[model samples]
Target chain A: MTTQPNLAMRNWNQRVGRTALYLVLILACVAYLVPLVVMVMTSLKTAGEVQPGTIFMWPENPSFDAWIKAWSQACIGLDCRGIRVGFWNSVMIWVPSLILSILAGAILGFALSRWQTRHAGLILGLVLFGAFIPLQVVIYPLIKMAANLGLYNSFAGIVVVHIIFGLPVLTLIFSNFYVGIPVELINAARVDGAGFFRIFFGILLPMSRNILIVALVLQGTGIWNDYIVGVSFGTPDIYPMTVKLQTLVGSQFGEKEYNVNMAATLLTSLPPLLLYLVSGRYFVRGITSGAVKG
Target chain B: MATIEIRNLTKQFGAVQVLKGIDLAIDDRDFTVLLGPSGCGKSTLLNIIAGLEHQTAGQIMVDGTDISPLPPDKRRLAMVFQSYALYPTMTVRKNIDFGLRVAGLPRAEIKERVRVTAELLQITDLLDRTPARLSGGQRQRVAIGRALARRASVYLFDEPLSNLDAKLRNDMRIEIRQLHEDLGATAVYVTHDQVEAMTLATRIALMNAGRIEQYAEPQDIYDRPETLFAASFIGSPKMNLIPGTIRLADGVPVFDTGSDRISLAHYPFRLAPEDGMPATLGVRPEDVAPDAQGIVARHRLNEPHGADTLAWFTYGETNLSARLEPVAARALGAQATLGFNLHKLSLFDPKTERRL
Candidate 1:
């Protein structure tokens, strides 16, 4: 109307507001993506570019050298290998541990929910509380005991350790999920003459679709990411990814090679991360469904 | 299809005694209903008979075998829960036959039994459906079908119709009654709804705070309630009680219901206890009539429930009600009186509220 705060002032104010909003959004996006972007770029870069703090910049010449090296060989105190040396060993320990822990946790959960015996709350509370305990605190005693039994540093030893450590949280999650179910379901099963194990296999197990998926995702992730337990208890024959990754990106005395480290890290986390991304929607739905049931 | 005897059964959870010494014998085809309010321990008794719950002390003889030591599977009884407890993961067909297969029945017989039960319940279409996809009414039918498929000797229903909507509940109630008639299997049902108990039960065992108040035919329980709890609980809108003294008027016993008195022409039983001392006289609202000769009460509020009219009135401090015709209750907010037949009057000892 009148002067309208003059052309230059109005234009400058509009420009500033729009610029600030966009700057914020850009910062947010960069803040989140920087680590992942750096990881990918570092994986492609040579050793010299990584330590110079030019991580935000792109690799001068992108190469598959780090990928091949991480998969085949990169020295770690005479081993001269990357993630490959222990990748299969990690697999050997994880596959069985994940399977057995879920089985035990699921069974325990079913029993706690369906069968109403005395001390149900107490048992449930103990299992839930056990999940919060720091696993590192219990590692030494477990390792000593494992050695005492002459089962130390073996694949079976590590698998069993993973199972024992994994059971508490897995069982807690499963038990809480199962308790949301209607007692009427179990009662109907019982009235149909289905006993303890029968009801679990026939009724409870089948309905536990989403919870089982979530349990798989959770236990799979925990077992895959396990480090201290695997390193301390597992033998040289079965050192999983966590320990192997640490050695892959070892000391800073020599020019560090983050290229191979990034590749190794991404490789190790890929399986469980992919597992979660695929089933993340189901996981959310499972928890929300249980919340509304009660 | 066998008579069951529950003798001197008692159950205690830790230090708290739930069911104190209960004894009853049910016939081979009796539709026995354990009717009571919540926390009355009726469900506990049913579970005990089904062998799902063990008695702290006593014997349960099912078909003349002591089944106290036996588990629920071995006892051969079926139960229907309130929530219908349908297996959501399995199809209805699998849910019904899950038990039979576990019992090691032949596949051929299982199929035959499933067909027969589905036809009987008219649930042939629901066989392929899982419980999650089922509506409330459908889930209920599937639950009944589950027990029906078993061909178990005894059936226990713990408020099975409680989860259904009102209209559907009535329909299911009638269907369950008809099914019971057709099968004539020995059954024990537990429910808080006295209407369900009255309509479905051949004999109602009225429980009050873990004790059986009375056990008799529905008609007998209604017409002549043994205790105050049964009389108050077994009917809709409940009966009204007026504190009045009994006196020998006109050479016969008569009850003075505060404002007015009723003279018994000739009641089958004594009008009052041998020494009742005229404590409290109970009269059902339906029986209390709006007439000049009846007890007078100022009309306070009128609630017209279509077929019947419920009028709340007052005589001094005591507010009373009479269920009458709509036209009769049209003269609202006026001093009204109602006549009560002394022959229909129920006398209860003021202290214990037990009918005399």
Candidate 2:
């Protein structure tokens, strides 16, 4: 139906346009990846090789000495050791806090969706308002209350603090996920002899796989990297890795063991970085889907 | 099988009363259809009965037990939603087995019932697949299979066929009728379709503006509707309503349409001409056939609707539709005079719009 040369030129134009867009995207992705690559390569280098002058090259010799130093033998304050000082504490905090916050968000989401009881909208509004309050404003009152309750600087206190901070975002995510489910599904479940909890646990929970996985991965990243709550409520013996990393990098500045600092910084971000590598796309999808009603 | 008695059930949504004191008693194993147009409280009533919604004030008795306070799970009722809410993540086997499993039935019995329901609903091959992979009809079958597996005392269908294409809708309607006949289950179905209500219901509860206008068998509702709303709402192509004055002529009520005066039969209009009240005349389009010996009328328009044609003509300011034979309909609008059978005319008082 068309001339051969004209059709060929049109196809060539389309190919050029597509290739241009793909090239832009590829460049952007490379730009984002470069920082992580530098952190890893610098973590492998010796202190002399990691000097600012050699910003973009591989070291002539890579060694495990810096990694070992970052793990256990470096001086941080009076305690001469690595950021590994609170590794178990970080795991302990990250696990229980993540579990409790996610479960709380999901339970509240299901209750609000199903029962729709009196003052339910008001209650949900209060929760949303709680989320908008600045953490600084609540921290003083929370500390006072924690001290009054004999829980200041305790593991339970920190765990409870993480939960309180995590509620708004986690509730927002689960509520938005539950809202996306069709109301007809719940009505059908009701008519099929399922009560509220039964419908949530049996039907709604199973259908919410993509979003739940996204929630766990997100909460894992948030609590694992949290430094504010760790420093605020944790005892010296129970400090999380993030706080330990902060102190280690702070005091070991002059005579700057650049290798050890870079290694600790690299390790500080490894869990979340690896997590992002695996579940990154789904995480973004769920977060955006939760925000956008459609 | 069980009987359902709804005594003075009412519902209000944000100051707008939906179902205003509805009283109904569905006979045991009867297929009762709540028929209405959109915005009517038919669906609200169905939901109230299904325990998916709570009535503001009322009593609902099933099998002589008051179930007003019972949660949906304790009501022993199953409903097929209009959207056919099949679990998209589960296979047909899991979906149909859900209720049985919840009841703590043994695994073997659950499997056997799931197989039986799947086969009966003609979805045996689809038991391995999720609802997303099935066609519209297959999904509907799975929905019915899920309801069937429950074996509840009452089955509620909320416009379950409204989602299908016209052909599939009719096929499923026939299938539903046959299914009801085979099971003899006490089913309460809701639909806005006249033909579906007519063909499928043992009795119909015609609702309008949140009130039950009439409740009777399909033919009775067609033959003698209680109100002007029911009379006009129940039939296809609709009944023509002509307004005019009426007077008693030799002990028979005759309508005076200014141009022509016609004698009425079999209507109870005791109001004298001294009242001088306005009146409405009603007649079905199909009843206005052109017979050899009949009343004289003028033809105004002809509409060919395939299978049959509609003849529209005005005697005065009132327009009337009549069903004419295909040949006779074609002869219409060719500048010819036609005839009407006054024997089939339906007259109503224009002021109150009640049957005369």
Candidate 3:
């Protein structure tokens, strides 16, 4: 008889505890989502409806005029075209940089982990340490070096900068990922008459799909959204979307168009958002598998 | 098929010497097992022969040609790893054809070879499936099939069945032996299991601490172990070793155990026994049986093992085990008299640990 009452009380307590946990989780999620909700709502509202109190409310008469204006007609200084002007430029800078950087990183990581030289440990340590150093600290010297090579404020200059900054993290991801692969597999390939490149491309590279997606998400977002590197190194004609977006929104003397600005902000973040949505599962698995093993 | 000759092979990993001047000659079409406990450099020796690892100082001759300068692929050898090491991303068919494809064989030849190899391994239905979808035994067959497709002169197995369950291991062992007989390929297999070594090898090179303790046929190694380690390592439940001294009583050799003296008059010694020399006597458990005219010992424990029961008894300070029929062991009470089979007894020098 006592056991029956005790079991009922225990069940009640568990239900209350679970409900409280769910309530707190919901509150946290709503708190984090508030700003994003406000941004989208403001972007959809007309200019007159975009006042302080109406920031979080759904627009009564929503229009995509701001999205269109932001894409092609909003003015930033003398240029009235908008964020669309630098979209192709951002793609050009990001795609080549992403490919070259990932390739270089994978090769470096493979060599460091598998065909280790005497200095591999020291070099890996140095690379990992370099990941912590602020990119701002190296920017000035990089500018001088870029100018000496006659690539300052040019497309090549920005691509090279992205690769350089991206190398440390990319190499760390790939090296840790490759370390989990058995050494016998590599030996088996060698006995199968595979040379270094053949084994790497045929055997290792195929198995690295998950980690590669993780790297692409990281490097793609970082390089795509990069503003400082673009501003410091890109010329006016080759301004990346981020630099162009900054100039579009950073007006000094005109009445601010918050709707247009919010629209542009969402547009610039769309690529990374779509990437995460597409490859989110692989991203989580990759990080845990590579990082947890090490 | 090729005869492998390893002359004075030595390997050192920095401060630790892994292979200490190992010299072994494997005959053509032989199933040679490198048998040892872990860290005995058996795998390292196999890797050196396959050219996957470089020996510190050695000359490896395959069919009278020194293959020291060649790489693993050039050595014409294929190996099955302990882990199976199948490519997880590849289908079984692709895994089998990878070596030949990389060697740039014609497409039809590669296909025919893979088909025949898969059929040989009885894995034709599994060729389209990835390794992750296969069972452990099937994965091992695919790994072996990959090696078979290579058609190398020598096949190396690095404890390929260590990961399987007991029943699967037994089935695979018989299959591997049958395959060896059918192909007549020279194979070097490494394993720590004494049963695997005994069942699979035409010759067994028993290694200890980077040295070959004994190298001979499996039965020869079992019957005439040259050292104490060999005798102890080869048998299950282990050979019972009794430490004592050889003393001359009436000009006849006698093993004096301080508490009991056993006559060694009929025992054959590798060398003539000296009086008052410390020696260890070794005898298999099955050789000891119940007899009225034998030494008396107190029965401590009895372990029933289906076909036979192991009876433990104390003789002096050492507890000795004997294999007996279950009924015979069960009939015994707190005490039992055990007799040693003199013809099968082994005597070892205590100092050198060699058979005397």
User: Candidate 2 residues B113-222, lDDT tens each?
Assistant: 89889888888988899888999988999999999988886999999999999999999999999988888889999999999999999999999999998889999888
DockQ of each: 0.55, 0.66, 0.59
True-contact fraction per candidate equals 0.80, 0.69, 0.67
Q: What are the iRMS values of all candidates?
A: 1.5, 1.1, 1.1
lDDT of 2 at B21: 89
Ten-residue region with minimum lDDT total, candidate 2 chain B: B333-342
Q: Write the per-residue lDDT of candidate 1 for residues B1-356, one digit (tens) a residue.
A: 88889898889999888998898899999999999999999999988887677899999988898988877777778888887877777898987887788788999999999999999888899899888888999888988888888888898898999988999999999999999999989999999998999999999999988788999999888877777787788877777767777666656666766666666445454434342266566677787777667677788888899998988877666667788889888865577767776667677777787877
A44-155: candidate 2 lDDT, tens digit per residue:
8888887665767987788878988998887777777677886777887888888898888887866765565677677778887888888787888888899999878877
RMSD of each: 4.6, 3.8, 3.2
Better of 2 and 3 by DockQ: 2
A4-60 per-residue lDDT for model 3 (tens digits):
999999999999999999999999999989898888988898888886655767898
For the candidates in turn, chain A alone yields TM-scores of: 0.84, 0.86, 0.94
Clashes of each: 4, 4, 0
> What are the lDDT scores of the predictions, listed in order?
0.82, 0.82, 0.90
